[model samples]
Target: MSGPRMTVVFATRDRATLLPRVLDRFAELQSPPGGWSLVVVDNGSRDRTVEVLRSYTDRLPLTALSCPQPGKNRALNAALQHLQGDLAVFTDDDVLPEPDWLVRLRAAADSHPEADLFGGTVLPDWPQPKPDWLCERAVEFSVLYAQQRRPSGACGFADIFGPNMAVRSAIFAAGTRFAEHVGPDDTNPLYAMGSETELLRRLEGAGHRGWFEASACVRHIIRPEQMEERWILNRAFRYGVGEGRHYAGRRSVGLLVRRLVYGIAARGSALLPPSPRRLRIRYRDRWLAGVAAGRPAARASPPSG
Candidate 1:
């Protein structure tokens, strides 16, 4: 089969200040054989996000959409109707793709025609100096909502990071959509993440394959506010909660109780010292708490336009 057409999709809310810079970067990106357009869904931003998007209409192949509904997944599902590409590339509103990012993705797709999913690398672009404490756990955590950094290679797992992933349009045609309740909802702290996690896992179980292309890279901008420990801890808590949602079906009430018991023990251990062990213990406790509170499975729903 030939390389399919591509359309990059991303949803944003309330970040009017940063979306313009991202669009500037998109303007610099080189397209693949069939060319690609952009679909930016504004998830009810009270700010001038739509105006900012409209301003860029003459600068790029852009479509500005307004999704007054809540949630990132809802916005994404809503934007699906507007996409006119054989492959849907997903990224964040704050990301900067390399000039050849789409070219590399096309190359990978052309080489691996049998694969239906693709993941790429996401590097961090710190706007200012990164504090040591922040860099300490950076390798383990995305810290800035960038794709999780990993070694260069191909893999079978559907662990595609939301910041840089692509899927065949056919998958959506098969009636699959991102789990409505699993992703971040405009800073709603209670929302369990992993919108792509649940969807990709579903795709993988159906025998669809995925490939990781390291060269198709993008830079995720990290602002100063995210450098604080308080912010990082909150992110960690949400990540743990997402993990709990992933394991919900496999967990029995008795098993969950046991995990919480162990988590409590870990919390006690966390107080022993200020070493790595302490950090690990604290992380474990928060993750377990998320597991206890998060829903095991996503509720199914049709995509809304």
Candidate 2:
């Protein structure tokens, strides 16, 4: 039997400086027997991202498209129509796949014909001289960076993280799409965080199974600015927002009280030594606060294709 034909999809915005390195890694990917193509959607980048993508046309089987919309999901939804192949692999622009990434995904799809979704390990590509705090909390904070390392086998949609995930193209062909209202929007700071999770869960609910391919790994680049305390805490809050939206019906008076108590305790813990416990509590508190906020009000509609 022939290997699965694949279409790798990712959206980007204002990451001109990072695109070249990412595309360089893509150029290094070992193509599967059925071959593969890339569809990169530029989501309203004002920087030199367009020019950078143009320069890579000769190096990779790349189809660069534009959404001009601010949200990551909006851009992704637009690219769905352009996909080619039996598998639709989704990842972020900042992620660097191992040379055998696509080959492994194709193999997994071939091996598990029953599964419709696939996820791989995502390790951090930390900056040199990594901060002590990050070192201590890397595993605890992995979700903030969309990183995961799970055993290869049957898995749930929650285990299939963004940054490194693939789904059968038939799903998209049937009109399933990333939620436009939730996910990263360049114009909105308080946007909900689970752009991919929402889609994965919806698919799973529809009876689609997922598989984790341990050998197919990718490295998510840890940017310098993300190392700061403020950024980390803010990310924690956003994560909670996503969780809150995911479990919107679970809120209650008891939960509200617990959140208030935790919020106060987290604030008091700040004066003590910066241990992982303190940071964890603080992160939990921020997440609780976000849960209280629930989903943000609906934003402007994404631009039509």
Per-residue lDDT over 162-266 for candidate 2, one digit per residue giving the tens place of the 0 to 100 score: 899999999989889889978999777766788888999999999999999999999999898887666777777777677778887664567678888987888
What are the clash counts of all predictions, listed in order? 0, 0
Model 2 off-target regions past 4 Å? Answer: 135-139, 295-305
Query: Each candidate's TM vs. the true structure?
Result: 0.86, 0.93
TM-score attained by model 1: 0.86
Candidate 1: regions farther than 4 A off: 1-4, 136-139, 150-153, 252-278, 295-305
What clash pairs does model 2 have? none
lDDT of 1 at 21: 90
Judge candidate 1 against the unseen true structure and give its global Cα lDDT, from 0 to 1.
0.76
Full-model lDDT for every candidate: 0.76, 0.84
